[model samples]
Target chain A: MLSVNVRLFGTLSRTFEDYHHSCGLDIAIASRGDIHDLLVHLDLIGESIGMVFMDDKQVNNTTKLNDNARIKIFQPIFGG
Target chain B: MNIVRVDMNARKITREIFEPAFTGMGGRGLTSFFINREVPPGCDPLGPDNKLVFAPGFFSGSTLVNTSRFSIGAKSPMTRGIKESNVGGTVAADMARTGISAIIVEGRPNNGQSFILKVDQKGDVTLHDADQYWGKRTYDLVASIKEFYGNKISITCIGPAGEQQLSAASIQATDRDGRPCRAAGRGGLGAVMGSKGLKALIIEKSATNAEPIQDLEGFKASAKIFAKAVMDDEFSAEILPELGSAVLVEPINAAGAFPTRNAREGQFEDADKISGEALAQIIKSRGGKPNHKGCSGCIINCSNEYVDEKGEFITSSLEYETIWSMGGMIGNNDLDSIARLDRLCDDIGLDTMSTGVAVAVAMDAGYKEFGDAKAAIEMVEDVARGTAFGKILGHGPEMVGKHFNHDRVPVVKGQSIAAYDPRAIQGMAVTYSTSPMGADHTAGWVVDSNLEAFGGTLDPFSAQGQVENSRNTQIHMAMVDTVGICDFAQTGFGAPDGLENVCKMIAAKSGKPFCEADWKSTGKMIIQTELEFNKNAGFTKEQDRLPRMFYEEPLPPHNKVVVIQDDDMDSTFAF
Candidate 1:
């Protein structure tokens, strides 16, 4: 099993507050799992997660996940 | 589109035809062009020679979303430079529907009597004495006018701060709910309006149709595509309309870029307490508007009607910057207090950001204690009352810093910096230092996506590639402002084809040739005009750099200082 540290941003914290407490949630995934698998496991609104950053770099939904990968999800936010 | 010129000194008004020289120009484009052409560089901002021009954007009055941006221009009493402050509300759309492209108020009244400029339903302009309304709070004044013009009227006015000719005053505009929450704030343009003896500009809801589009079918197709893209974006659809602008508090805080306690710290411990998530929770429990439409045609709906504990409306749009400025910057964690301060700013007609920074500077200098919510409210009320102490606080951060002899004044060219700490986001340092508007965030905002989308490769902690990044974003934003697109629509504009569609809409509307190629060139033209205006007003390379405190003080969390060099700033206008 591979584990990734994930933090949700904006409305995501509220959506997944039961699991994450605030914004961060630690999840274990199968070997070579991608962002799709993570989103499925979390059961978050798929379209709402516009950008996914794996270790401070942008990645797509199909990008491969590795052991202990740091992930942060951002919704589309403008204005301030 | 006609230009209505009101000569206050002679008590005469004239309607002149919009010139071909300023054709295809609206909003900041027209205001800046007209100011640079007419107003002398060295004239006093509050003098008769300095004119106050208000013009709506190109797509205003049209069936366009997010085109209700009003550009108010003048020689700034705060920065002593040509300034154009953009506001969002129903005023821009309603004023544009009057078939008047711009309202230019010139000269000064001898007796210094207050007056209101009214444009009726039939496109007629008249001046009315404002003796009863003068010195009143903007919200009350707006309500008084609403009684006369009824609900369909849109108003742009100032409060006692402007009446007292404070340099930090902002001209407040009525939002969709007739609340004076939308403001053309920054650069003391309100003082110019006050100087002209004008209290407010009341526009009756017009019966006229949208601006004539040259290629109607083509424009419709392009506009449909653009509107669909904006409305379809995940951020626009889910985050903005749901949580409003305050939602930015978390992501920015998580990224270690949220400025706190006057930029002494990069991240605040109480960030979540004053965040959009918490704000939403509070609004839910209090049972007020969770997501309110701020402007006339704002599809994003990124503003909220904040309510008190009793579930009464206190203010509209307690946005991220305002939350950060009034909350973390002053070390105050109370969201309700911050909401009240936002309300005070709207009512008193002052820049919330400037007012916050000023209070922060004063607190740092021992005028008040940090985290003292009562003291913060008192300080703000001082500005409203026009007291001697209030006058110091009303002069904005730089002057307060000078008065208290405190060195850590976070300002660029006299205007206060926004919520983002420059040290954490080095690209913002470039934007704040070199933007012709002086420390304005809207000139160009750099989030993580902005770096990747614009092809900018830079270490945000260090100085590499930041100058280029700032230059590119600044130029692109200039085009957006000139063409009258809202920054929130960047969810669409940031897409590969997003900005192209924006240019397409403009080209279709005016029958002009503009695409991505012209985007950068058009932005350059507008920026050059602004830079020329600033240059003539005695701003040189020295004024184009960030304050020394930003360079010396190391912000916590990342512990990075603003390392962008002055040499890089000199090249910002090299284009």
Candidate 2:
């Protein structure tokens, strides 16, 4: 099993009432789990995800996760 | 459609049929084309020779959703170049419904007096002596106008900043609620209006005369499809309506492009406190209105009414760019202070983006410490008071930078750059450097296409596809602005057959064929005209480059500097 840290931003964070923005959430997943598997575990499937970053680099749902990986998820954003 | 020409010097108003050559033109297309042909490129922007034009989008008065956009054009006193500052308010629809295509204000008043132009329900134009409103701020002036001229009208006016002919002055327009919070807020066009001795333009909201559409049924069908698509898109339908444009704060910060402390840093430690999530949460807690509609026929409702802790109204809409300018750019994190600053800028008739960045530049130069919200507020208030330092701040970042001898000022052609940092997003570097409108993010918002998570094809830090992406996006955005489509609602164009549906609507209204190809060409024509004016006005490829800071200093987190070559920037307009 691999432990991944996840941080949600914008409206996505509001879904988890007790979610800490700075501290993020820690979850253990299978060693071969990708972003899709991680989203499923977090119950974020079908959510309007704007961008996702793993260790500071943007990643898609199909990208595989590694041990101690840090993930940040955001709602779709439009600029002014 | 008719054009109303007001000669300020003669105090004469005349109505004539719009030029036959501009049959299908509207908004920026009409404004740019007119300014290019009539105004000399080298003419002083604040002199008698300059003209201020107001034009609504073709779909403004039609039964289309989210089309209340208008273009206010003039030679910029700041950039010294052609400018079409687009704004959204009830005035666009009201003006269009009066069957007036454009209102052109020409020449300066010989008597050095101020006046207001009133357009009645019958579309008759008249000029009135407005000496009483000469130095009033926008909020007070708007209330006075409503008290005197009834509440059922839309007003576009300038405040003390414009009256002073400040380079960062903006023309404030009334929103759906009769609040003059919407602004044609760039290029210092309000200074042009003030120089012409025009204080305000009042249009009767009761006017119901709309231009005839050739195929009403077909237009309505396409309109419905476009509206549905806007309602269906995730960014337009859900996130924006829930969080407003402030939703960009977190994602952009995460991308290492939030631009903090006058672009000295890429990220602000306190960014989350001022982000969309926090903004919406605070509004909800304070009993303010979220999901507020700011413009006519807008279904996205991305605007919000910000209130004090006691639940009293402070500002109509606290936007993302203002949040950054007053927040991270100046190294401040208090949302309440930012909201108040937004109201102050709106009241003073100044561009919040420019005003904030000017203060940022001042803070960077050690005039005041960064994160000093009190000092920032005082500086903005000084612009209204016309204090000596206030005069310097009102002219925007370049002037402020010069005043303090600051070398890190992030600007292009006198105008301050927006929220996105070009170092982190190299595509934006190309757009910021090449766009006729200097450092304007909206001129070509290539942020989405540069991020992989947004299904972007290019790398954000690489220069490989940056120039081409910016060029295509800039051309498309030109057409979008000409059509007066709200940038947030442009997601409708992404739906299957959405672009074609828009074309069909155009054809139905103009009784002419319009396709994707024509869209590109029309956009290209508008850019070419603007470029020609700038070229003649003595702008060269050298003026298109970003400041030395962007290329020399590497932004943190990503630790990347701008890598786009100068030759690549010059190639953007190579049709």
Candidate 3:
């Protein structure tokens, strides 16, 4: 199992009342787990997440997660 | 619908039916077509030969949601090119309800006099003396006008910056609350109004006289479908209303395209502090209203009222662009100072993007230290005070860069680039370099489609497929602006039957057959007219290129320069 750091942004932060913005939530996932598995593990599978970033790089659902990877999840952003 | 012509030189007003050539055109379509046909291309932008036009979107007076987009267009003193800046407010709906399509201001006043134009609910047009209101700021001017005309009228006016003919000046339009907060804040159209010696326009509100729909039943049906589509889109219905446009701060910064510290850095260290989430939290804690409606008939309500710690009004509708401009661009993390600067720009009638970029250029040239919020506030105040340095800043970033001999200025044809840096998002590079509107983000927003995490297919760092994408997007936006649809409300077009429903509405209004192909053709026509106008105004292919910094400098994080070829950029308008 690999422990990865995850930060939830916008309204997603409110879902976890104990979540702190500066201190990201850490979750253990299977060594071969990908973004999809992580979403299922975090119970955000059906949530409205606009974008997901791993190590500051945009990643897709099938992208593999690495140990200590920095993950950031954001809601939809409407640019003017 | 009728077009009103105000001849300032003769102090005359005339009403005329639309010529067959100009029928079925409104908003940007009418403004660009009229300027291309009547105004001399090579004339000085602020001279008498130049014309200023105010037009509403085609669906303004209808029962549609969020269609009150009003376009103000002219040859811009800042870019020396054709420009259109649209604002969302009650004015468009009010003018449309009065059965007016466009108001054309022609020929500057010969005598050194100022005047105000009034359009009554009965559609009668009159010119009044505005000597007493000539130098008043937009807020005070709107207040005075509303006091005299009752609270029912909408006033589109300029501030002292416009009277000074500053290139960064903007035309301020009153929102639904009768506050002059919504702004046509690009292209320096306010200077053109000032050059014409026009102070304000008081348009009487009307509950009757909406543009007659030939097939009212059909129009209503299509409008219902379109409105539902907008409401169904998660971005429009949920995200925007909850977080406002400032929600972009996190995603854009995460994508490494936020354009922080004058484009030297792609991400701001304090981005989280001035982000949309922080803004909403602050507003809620301070008793400010979020999810507020600033435009008429707007259901999404992406606007907000920012108040001070004491719960006093600071400004209404603190937007994403302004937050990026005053926060990350100048390296200021203080949201309070940014809100104050936003209010000052609104009151003084200046473009916050241009003004902020000008200050950033000055700070980059060592005129002041970066992150000095007080200095940033004072420089913007200087433009309002008309200080010697203020006049230079009001001319925008290019002038400030030249004054300080700085080569890192991020401008295309004198207009400052918006929040998005082109190096990180190559599609934006193509859009900024090729757009006739001069680095305007709204001209072609390919940001979302270029970021892979956001379900975008295009590679943000690649040149392949960027030109074609930008060209199509620009064409679509030209027609979107032509029809006067708010960009936010355009989530409707993403629905399964969105385009078809909109076509039905257009066909219902014109009593003519319309389809998607006609939409493309109309957009293409508008752009072709603008490109021709720019060419005749002495612009060449060289003017359709980005500044050297974007090509040479490697922005932090991504460290990628604009990779789009010049040939690709020139081919963007080949259609």
Candidate 4:
């Protein structure tokens, strides 16, 4: 079992919980599962995520998320 | 049109006819024009030769929304470069009402005596003795001036810091509540006003029958549409009034670009303490007003008055830049402390953003501890007193950095970076680097696609296509400024035909046949003029580069440095 910690920001923070509490992903995949696939398995729309981060490093939305990696997603919204 | 010249040294008021070429330009264009034509490069900015010009935009007195901004221009005593700062207040509209185009203060008072310039509807100007009001704070001075001139008149006054000729001094303007809160607050223009021996400028509402626009009905039609669009928009209608500009805290913090602790880190650990949500809660608990209040003829009022827990006034118009500078940047999340600091800046006539950055830099240099809100407030108070350390901080961010021997100062071209950190918002980085005005975020603020379809990379962290996005936004911003409207109205420009409607509005007001091409041409012309002024003022491509700290420090979360190369910076000016 692989557990991925997810955090949301901006409009995503407003719409979804900052931390997803014990969400289960149906896929049992290798280390090469892209973020798009992860979102798809979680029933999340790709357009809602503007930027993605994995392990404190900014990665493209298409970049793969490793097992036990911490992922942060930001929606397209501006303040000020 | 006339130029009212106030000579504080000789206590003389002279009126001169406005040149025809300067007939249409106001606000930024008028100030930039005056600086370019009149001010001698390399002249002592504090000396009598440097002049400060105050002009209202063309549509300032009309029914147009967000058209009430006034511009103040002078060769900066701090940066020793061209400076133009604008603020929203009733004074600009009142000036237009008095059948005056602009007021130019030339030469200096031979003696150290300060005076006030008073103007009435009959075009009469008087230089009154202001010795009694010299050292008074902005609030006290405004109250006294109002008592003397009646509440109907609008006055722009400087505080003790300006009277002392502090380099970071600002000129304060009264808001609707009669608080000296709004400011023409940048580039030490208040010092220029002080150098001329002027304490304040009082403008009585015009009794003359003068209309601002040529075609009233046509202008009214277009302005109504524009105002409706602004008021009807979800972002402007919903978020702005509720949060003011403090709404930016969370997103910028998330992007690792919130400018924490004098730019040492891009994100603040205590951002939640000062976020817009937090501010809303405070306002609700304290029974503070949260709706938009107009400056003059503005219907889309984005300004608010914030009150403290004891029902005491803290500050009016708590903005995003102020929140970021005093809260996140200094690592002080105390809203009350931030409000007090803001009030200090307002009362003393200083730039809050620059002063905050200076204080943060001082803290980094071991002059004060991080998150020392009281100490930070004290340092700002020193600026008013002209104390030894206050003098250092009053010189602005670059000088303060040098004084403290801090190498991590985030300033470009001697001006401190605004609230947005460039490493997080790459388009903003381009704007800060390449803008003629050093490190001004408003030069080209990037609107999110959801807010406005500015059409750029959805991901702010990506450098790809940011330069082009910035350039396009800059052009649009120039057009907005030229039209004398607030950039907050930009959400309406998202529609395909929005630019055409803007042109239509201009055509109706000026009686000129303006079209989309005309708008583009005017924007290009404004940019070219600014570029020419900078070039003549000895600014080169080297000055356009970001500070070295951005390249060295890897911002957290993203852990990415400002990777835009010098070549990319050079290419920005290729246009």
Between prediction 1 and prediction 2, the one with superior TM-score is: 2
Candidate 1 lDDT over residue span B1-575, tens digit each: 58899999988999988663423578888888888888998899999999999998888877767889899999898888878899998988898888888989999999978899998877799999888899899989988988876888899999988887888999999888888899888988888888988999999886484467888888777777777888777678777877788888866765567877777888788987897878987997899887888898888888898899899999998888889889989999999999999999889999999999998898888888889989999999999888888998888998899899998898988999998888888988999999998899888786553434223356778787788877888888776777677778766664457777777778887787767777777677778888898899888888887888789988877788988878887887887
The DockQ-derived docking category for candidate 4 is incorrect
Query: Judged by DockQ cut-offs, is candidate 1 incorrect, acceptable, medium or high?
Result: acceptable
Summarize candidate 4's per-residue lDDT along B276-299 as a digit string, tens digits. Answer: 667766877798775658487766
In model 4, where do residues sit more than 4 Å from their true spots?
Answer: A1-80, B19-24, B206-212, B292-294, B447-455, B458-463
Best candidate according to lDDT: 2
Clashing pairs in 4: B9-B109, B170-B349, B292-B301
lDDT of 2: 0.90
lDDT of 4 by residue, A36-74 (tens): 776765556734555566766667747877888877655
Colliding residue pairs in candidate 3:
none
Tens-place lDDT per residue, model 3, A7-43, is 8886676668788767779999999999999889988
Which of the two candidates, 1 or 3, achieves a greater TM-score against the reference? 3
lDDT at position B227, candidate 3: 84
What value does the lDDT take at residue B240 in candidate 4? 68
| Native-to-model Cα distance after best TM-score fit, residue B290 in candidate 2, in Å | 1.9
lDDT per residue (tens digit) for residues B1-575 in model 3: 58999999999899898853533578899899888888898999999999999999888878878899999989999989899999998999999999989999999888879989998998889999999898898899988877777998989999988988999999999998889998999989889999999989889997487779988999898888888888988889887887898988888998888988888999998998998888988999899997799998999999999999999988989989999999999999999999999999999999999999999999999999999989998998898889989999988998899899998888887888999999999999988888888989999999978876566789999998899888999999998897888999998887677887888888898788888888888888899999999999999989889988889999889899999988989999976
Q: List, residue by residue over B519-571, the lDDT tens digit for candidate 2.
A: 88888999999999899899999999999999999999889999999888899
* Chain A TM-score across all models, in listed order: 0.83, 0.93, 0.93, 0.63
Displacement of the residue B468 alpha carbon in candidate 2, Å: 1.3
For DockQ, candidate 1 versus 4, the one ahead is 1
